[model samples]
Every structure is written in structure tokens, then in C-alpha cells.
Target: MSFAADSPFKSISILYRKSHIWLNEGCIPCDLTAAQAIVIMIVCDFSTLTQDEITKRLSLDKSVIAKTVTKLEERGFLQRTTNPKDKRTYDIHPTEKAWQVYPHIREQVEACFCRMTQTMSEEDRQNFRRLLDTAARAALNQEE
Candidate 1:
């Protein structure tokens, strides 16, 4: 299909949709949606983070982060403890369950990205990543 020469939106949207599907499918064995897997990975990486911190990191709404955290907590993958310095806020920590599944999640994420860039040479892959980062920053109106 021929796309308009001036626009990258169509290609970007298609890539986003396809990548989302691939990631979602890849996460099924872990019993996680892509969003849940991402959240777990972030919390695991950070060790402990507040809902607001997660919200900012992922650029997602506070309510979405709260709900995802609550679900993870209920599923035994995370624990929420009252922050020592902040009585009103809770710090999120990964539980044993999350630790157990961490490797699988990481593998799936790695596999997905590898598949996405499989046809590209190392140099091309690096360039693609740099370009994507530049585009993302521009879209977010951030200084490069």
C-alpha cells in the first residue's frame, strides 16, 4: 500500500498496534497483560516506587497506575507498604511471585524487541533506536 510521503503517522500507528499485539501475546504465559508486565518490570527495577512515581515514569494516569498496582498486589506479585517518611503514600515493592516471574518477563521483552529488529543490522538497529528516541522527545515537546 502506498502511503502519503509527508506523513509517518500511518507507519508509526501500524507499528504500535502490531507491537502491542505481539507483546500481549508474548506475555500470556506469565498471566500478564502487556501493561501489567511493564508495570511489574518497572516496579521490579526500581525496587520501591510510589504510585505517583510510577505514573510519571510511564506517563500514564495516576488512576491507571493505582489500579494496576492494586491488581498486582491482589495477585501476590507486589506489596504496598506505607512509606516511612510519608504516612499518606505507599511504596510499591515486588514480591517473591514477581521475582519468580521476572526472568520470564525479561526474556519475553527481549524476544519481542529482537524479533522487531531481526532484519536490521546492528548499525541500523542502533540508528533506529536513536531516531525513535528523537521522535519521541520531539512529540513530547522535550529539549533534545
Candidate 2:
């Protein structure tokens, strides 16, 4: 499946695949895959997001989040507590173990972005971010 060199959608898809591979490699020593590390980071950063919220934020399937959260919990990197207002839902939290390694995780994330955009000027980087945000929101809004 060849896409035109000038196609933005093709570029975005290629970027996502490359980014996933990069993250997976970087996360290997952390005893996590790229997706698991991403989930842990999200929980650590939010500190109070529900499973449903995580699914929406990552645009992943609920079952995938459930499995990832379960694995993290088993690894002592995360804790899930039932939401007081909704017994069926659970709020995810990063454990002390997760906090201890968060700096490394953060650095890995930053390094990936830096490497990806190393060739771009500051202005271009900012514009790229703005455009991505706009496109992402527009895509999500259209789904509603």
C-alpha cells in the first residue's frame, strides 16, 4: 500500500508506527511494552483518571486498557480503586514504584519527541504541534 509522499494522513500513519517501535525499544528495560509504559505514565500524570477515561484519552479499547492496567497492577506499578460514586468503575493510580521511575519514563518520552523533530525549526515545531492538536480535535469532534 503505497501512499503519496505528500499525503499528510500517510505521514501521520507512518509516524505512529515508527513512534510505537521506538517506544517499545526504549521501554524494554522497564519491564514494559510501549503501550504499558504509556498507560503507566498517563496514570502517574493524572493520578485520578478512571478506566473509562483512560480508554477515551488513549483512544484504545476498554478491554485493552483493562488488560494493561491489570498487568501493571500485578507488577506493583499501579493501583486501581473502585470509584466511590460508581461501583462498576475504577480509578487508576500509579504506585510508588511507578513514581520512582517516572523521571526515566519522562526522559524517554522527551527524547523520542526531540529525535522525531530534530530537523525542524522551533517555529515549525510549534506550528506542527498546533496543527496536530487541531487535526486531532477535529477528528474527535467529527466522531461525536
Candidate 3:
């Protein structure tokens, strides 16, 4: 069967590809891969996140998050300290370098999102985001 324009899988795949390329180019100055940059941003926003939390939030494999965190720690972009509440887990925190460039990264992400939704009306944008969020939550919940 031929793929249709309305296919959710195809649309999500296309969005993922475009977002990857955009983030990769945007993260060059930070010496981070798109994935790592995303993790850093999440950690900065959350202040304290564990590797498992990142894996869940990003819908990525635990090993991938572990490797990305290792790289970030190596680059001094983040710190992974033992979690006081959970002896078996480590809490991730963005370091000074991450905090310094966070504003730029945040601005780029916001601008990119704005550009992507520029043609949509306010209500359309709201509905689009709401649907995506709901879909994401459902997908995540389905895995558990």
C-alpha cells in the first residue's frame, strides 16, 4: 500500500528527521550531539533528573542515555551526583558551561518551533501541541 499524506507514522518520522538536523546544526558551538544537547536542556529545566528519568522522558533506550550522560560529564557540561533519595541512582545537573549556553539553545529551540507553526492559527497551534502531547503520553504509557 502507498503511504498517505495523513499517515501519523510518516508525519512523526518526518518531524523527527527535521528536528534532528536542526538541533545538530544548532548544537555545533556547544560541542554536543543533538541528543546530548537535548539531554542537557532537559536537565537544566528539571534541575535534577536521573538517567532512567531521561530515558523515559525522551523515549530513548537506557543505554543511549547512559552514554550521552557520560559524554556530557566528560565535556564538563553536566554533573551526575549520587541521588540522596535513591542510593542506586544518580541525579543529573547542568554545569556552568551548560547554564551559560542554555539561553542560546533555548532561544533557538523556541524560534524553530515558532517558525514551524507560523502558518497555523493560535487555536490550531494549541490543538496541534495538545494532540502531540496526548499522543506522546499514550505511546509512553503503552510501553509500560
Could you say which candidate leads in TM-score? Answer: 2
Query: Candidate 1: where is the Cα deviation over 4 Å?
Result: 1-6, 134-144
Which wins on TM-score, candidate 1 or candidate 2? 2
Tens digit of lDDT per residue, candidate 3, span 5-109?
679688678777877788788878877777888888899999889899899999998888899999889989999899998899999999999999788788767
lDDT of 1: 0.86
List RMSD in Å for every model shown: 2.5, 2.3, 2.5
Off by over 4 Å in 2: 1-6
Lowest summed lDDT window (length 10), candidate 1? 135-144
User: Candidate 2's error at 106, in angstroms?
Assistant: 1.8
Query: lDDT per residue, candidate 1, 1-144, as tens digits?
Result: 577365788778777787778879988988999889989999999989988889877777888998999999999999999999999999999999999888888888777777778989999988988998888767656522
TM-score, every prediction: 0.86, 0.90, 0.89
Give the number of colliding residue pairs in candidate 2.
0
- Which scores higher on TM-score, 1 or 3? 3
lDDT at residue 117 of model 3 (Cα atoms): 78
